[model samples]
Target: MFDFTPNPTFGPLQNPDLKVPTAAMDAQPETIIVGAVIDAISEQRLPAGAKLGEQALSVLFNCNRANVRRALAALEAKHVVELRPNRGAFVAAPSADEAREIFQARRAIERTIARQAVKRIDADGIARLKASIAAENLARSRRDKPAELRSSQNFHMLLAELAGNRVLQRFLAELTMRSTLILGMYAREGHSCAHCDDHTGIVDALIARDEALVLDLTDRHLRRLEAELDFERPVAVTVSLKDQIFGS
Candidate 1:
C-alpha cells in the first residue's frame, strides 16, 4: 500500500474533535459512515492505507458495529477501502499497476466524456468551468492546497456532469477518487501540473466548440496529470487508520 504523510496543504490530519452533523444520522447510519470515510479520504483526513476500526467508527458515529461493517462493505465496493480478513478494513492504497490502470481507464472514459461534452457545450457550461477555475485560483492565491485540490476535482466532476451521462458520471466519480489516491501516493515535488491550468485550455476549446481540440486537450490534460506521478520518489509515511481518524 502506498503511504501518505502530513501534507501542509491538507492541514493537520488528526481531527478527533471534528463533528459533522448528518441528516443521514436518522434514517441512514450507513450513509453517514460512508460519507465520513469518503470525506476523510478526499479531504486528506485519512491517508492511504489508514486503518478503519469498526469499534472506533461505531463509537465515533454512535452507530452499531454491524452498521460500521456494512458501511465499510459499501466503501470496499467503491474501491475506496480494502477489507482484509482477520485484519479489518483500511483506506485503499492502490498499487502502482492499479494506479496506472486507473489513469488509463480515466483517459479512455474522459476522452469519451469530452466528446459528449463538446456536443452539449453551452454558455452556461463555459461559465461554470470558469467559476471552478476561479475558485481554484482563489485557493492557490490563498495557498490553500487542500481547497485548491477540491476545486480541481470539482472541475472534472463538472465535466462529467456536462457529459450528460449519469452512468459515466458515476463511473468517473470512482475514477476521480482513485486518481486522488494515486496522486497522493506519487505526488511530485511541486504543484505545477496538479494546479490544473490545463483545465482552462479545455474550457477554451469547449467554448470554441472544437470537438477535436477538446479531445486532444482532455487527453493531454489527463496525460499531464498521469505524468505527475513519480514512482522514483518515496512513498509517504503512514499511520494507523483508527488513530489517524479518531486521535486514539
Candidate 2:
C-alpha cells in the first residue's frame, strides 16, 4: 500500500475523460499499462512495495485482468516491480546494498554517456537541455514535488538520449526507475536532491565542452543524492493502489 497526492504530470493515464486512441490501445494495451506503472514509480507517487492489484489496474486502465497480468509480468522482468508467488505484485524495494550498486552502475554508465554527449551535443541539444531545466525549475518553484521529480529524471534521460547510444539510454532509463524506488524507501526529504544549480552546472559544462568538469559534477550530484538517503530506517507511506495510480 502507498499514499499519493495528485500529480499533474500523470495527466494522460490519470484522466478519465481522456480516451485512448483505438488503434494504439489495440496495438499495445499491455505496453501502455506497463509504461503507466513505470511512470508512477519514476515519479515517486507509487512507493516501493505498494501492491499492484490486477483488478484495480484493469479498472483504472479500462483493460482486462489478463492485460494487467501481462503488464505486471513485463514490469517484473524490468526489475522495477515484483510478482510474489501468491501475494501478487508490488513495487520492488531494493536493499541498501542494491541501492549502492545501482548508483555505482549509474555513475559508470552516465560517465560514458556524459563524455559522448559533450562531444556530440549540438545547438538543438543545448536548447532541449535548457527547456528541460526550465521545466524542472518551474516545478520546484511551485513545490510540485512529483512534477519536479519527473522533470529531474527527464534531465538525466535527455543526457542519455543526447549521448546517441541506444543501449546506454535504455540502461539509464531502467536505472532511473529503480532509483525512484530507492528514493521513496530511503530519502529523508521525501524528494530528490535535485537542487536547481546542479543541472544548470552540468549544462554549462556541456556548453563549454568541458568533459572532465561535466563528469565530476555529474558524479558528485549523484553521490550527493545517494548520501541523502537514510538506508537504516526505511520509511514507507500507504494509500489505495487506485489512488496511487489515478491520483485521489
Candidate 3:
C-alpha cells in the first residue's frame, strides 16, 4: 500500500480493452488479448470449460486471427487453457487427479516460497501484503466476486514475489491457474472466495520471521482451499461464449 514496492511483472492483471482499436496501442495486440483472457478467467468471469473461439476473440479484440492464436498459446503454456488438437482452446478444466496433484505441488513449492519470503521480506513487503489483504476485504464487502478473486490471487502472488525466486514464481503462476480452474469446475456450491484469516496469520508469521509458523500456516491455508473443492460436482457446460467471457 503506502510507499511499498511496486510489482512490474504482475501478469494476467494488465487491463484488456475488447473494443476495436482506432489507433496503434501502447502494448502489443497479443499482450492485450492475453491479459484480457487471463483477467476474465482468473476473476471467474470465464467459467471452467468455456470455449474460447479465436474468431470471436479476434473480432472483439480488433486483431487478426494470428494475434488471437498467439495469445491463446501463451494462455495454454500457463495451463489456463487447454488447446485441443482438432478443437480450439477452452478454459481449463482439470481432472480430479490433476486437481489433487496441483494442490500437492502448491503445498511443496509454496512451503519453500514461504520460507524464502519470510527470510527476505522487508517492512515494505509486509505492508504491501497487508494492503492486499485490505483490498481483498473491501472487494468482499462490495460483493465483487471478480475483484475478490483477483485480490486473493494477488495476495498469493505477492508472497511469491517476496520469495525472490523468479523461477518458483513462474511455476506457481501455472499451478495457481490450474488450481483455480479445478476449483471453478468442481468447487462445491456456495463455496466462497478464499478465507483471509489464514493469509493474515501467514503474513504475521512472515513479519515476525517465524519460519516454522509461516510454513505451518501456509501449508494449512492451501490445504483448507483444497478441501473446499468437491470433485463429485461438475460445472455445466457453457455454450454462450459472451456470457462466459464477459459475464454479460
Number of backbone collisions per candidate: 1, 4, 0
Off by over 4 Å in 3: 1-26, 192-194, 237-248
Q: What is the TM-score of each candidate against the true structure?
A: 0.85, 0.85, 0.84
Specify the highest-lDDT model's number. 2
Distance from true location, Cα of 185 in model 2, Å: 1.0
lDDT of 3: 0.77
Better of 2 and 3 by TM-score: 2
Model 2 alpha-carbon drift over 4 Å, by segment? 1-26, 190-194, 237-248
How much is the lDDT of residue 134 in candidate 1? 95
- How much is 120 displaced in model 3, in angstroms? 0.5
lDDT of 2: 0.81
Model 3, 206-226: lDDT tens per residue? 878999999999998998898
Expressed as tens digits, the lDDT of each residue in 130-168 for candidate 2 is: 999999889988988778888988899999999999999
Residue pairs with clashing backbones, model 3: none
